[model samples]
Target: MKSFKHTIRALACAFTIAAVSTTAHAAELRLGSGFGDNHSSTRAMRDVFAAKVEELTAGRHTVSVFANSELGQAPEMVNQAQSGINFGVFVSSAFFNSQVPEIGVTNMPFIFSDRETAFKVFDGPFGEKMKPLFEAKGLVVLGFMELGFRNITNSVRPITQPEDLQGLKIRLQNNPVHIATFNLLGASPTSIDASEMFAALSQGVVDAQENPYAVINSFRLYDAKQKYVTDTGHFFDVIVFAVSKTALDAMTEEDREAVIEAGRLATLEQRSYAAADEATNLETVLSKGVELTRLTPEQREAFRTATAPVLDEVKSRLGAELVDEFLSAVDAAK
Candidate 1:
């Protein structure tokens, strides 16, 4: 009977220890983003990723998102994640070009024909190959979310031809390839963070900006006196979902796997939502009294041909071998 009593006591102690360990392992991560809370990217992290992480980990993990530059702009948030001050951030792929110029290869102007082709490339081996680039920068790329095709918006005038952009002061993301492309197209490009863009346009600090229709509608860029919007679709932008290597490394094996899987599923759903809403989002912009211009094939070709030199410039900046491999992968996807 004494042996039986001792065995019961030992089992109770073991149960107490296990419960304590589980409580100790529970983690609450903070996610940062440059987009508003209502944006698709933010919604994905909140509704999908956060929910899945809690469910997958059985309440052992949770993610709290800070949207709309609440943490900081893209570069600042990226730095925070790199330094382990923030757990993760969802930012445009263009922003990553500053750290890994090789990423610029993916931002080549007019390279992708449509959303389908773009999605194919990014969801394939080419996308897998780019993961290490972030890892090298102390970031673990979780998945790629869609920002969709970027269109040009200006307060100056309608951009119908390549020549129309001449003398226009355009605000571009701090991306060398983007600046080069705009310069080749005859616009004076100024690198500006997204948070500053609305005020820049409103105050005439910059006369033009380019972003996806969803972005234009969400940020209400039209209210900043943007009268003209052209479906230039010059570049397809991606929102990279990344976690700090520090945070990821600290996770248990099961928790890490859960995080990755949750990220992947969230990205897939976000892309589908963005793609499905493209037309409706464009309509929303038009309803706000903004003049929408659709480019004819010849007009689009003019912009494409004018900016073709940018490809060579990018190749020179971001190694020929890497660019070639990316192009080959894109071709294979085609």
Candidate 2:
């Protein structure tokens, strides 16, 4: 009888411990971002997501961030999330374009005239129509994170004309559209992953690369042997906060809303912060002793004209009708 009583008490203690642990871990959302935590956008996301999750869940749910490839490379992390290996990743259109070829429409070179046009397309129909497509692939896109516009940075001579890029070896994200676009512009495109780009640029594996000023500043590209910076603004980038559909489905309604709401707020705040920093970031690059090769408005137009073939190439990947729909939506947006 004593033995039976002792066994009963032990089982009760085990059950009690398990119950407490389960409750404690019941609603955690793990997020990953490509940029280091020090970057403004990454830091904004971490702070806003965590604070909003706690507020909306009344402290029952929470969020934590893994920044600077702590989870994995941006593209690989999204794949893992889609496969249900992890929670989610913050990734750019470059990451999504390869997965959903239909998404390549967003990668149309020189599509947006400015950040305002870019925002219109994203916040309007073009962005809304994409959520269902993402859901079909076991990923949940919470909100669009603006990656600003891409411009060329090179160790070679200044690129004031399209002919200047001839035979130049440029590092491009491992995306079909990006590679095709650069190839169309007469550069030898090397498909390098973002995590490896710094080393690739430093070692002369690539002569130039393109990214927004924020990235150039955040990654300290000035230290990577780059010489000239151009304001081609050739393409705008859009990153989505993607979560695993499996994980999202498992969350309680309240917890799920909390997570999504947190992401939406983060997007708004980050976009504002990014807009205000572009000039400052460009100035910082110059202050670091990197030479600026300002693209004349006419030269920018020529680069755009030269890359026009990329739109048709992008259409072929994303489907012609989808491309038309995306462009139409862009026109219709307020």
Q: lDDT winner among the candidates?
A: 1
Each model's TM-score, in the order given?
0.92, 0.94
- Candidate 1, residue 76: lDDT: 92
TM-score result, candidate 2: 0.94
Number of clashing residue pairs, candidate 2: 0
Error of 1 at 155 (Å): 0.8
Model 1 spans > 4 angstroms off: 1-26
Give one digit per residue, the lDDT tens place, for model 2 in 249-314: 988897888888888999888888888888898989889988887787888889889988887786
Q: How many residue pairs clash in each candidate?
A: 0, 0
Error of 2 at 43 (Å): 1.6
Q: lDDT of model 1 at residue 172? A: 94
**What is the C-alpha lDDT profile of model 1 across 1-334, one tens digit per residue?**
9999999999999999998886654477889888877788988899999999999988889889999899988999988888889889898998887666777899999888877788788888888888888899899998889998999999988999999999899999998888899998899999989888899999999999999998998889999989999999999999988889988998899999999999999999899888887888899999999998999999999999999988788888888898898888878877
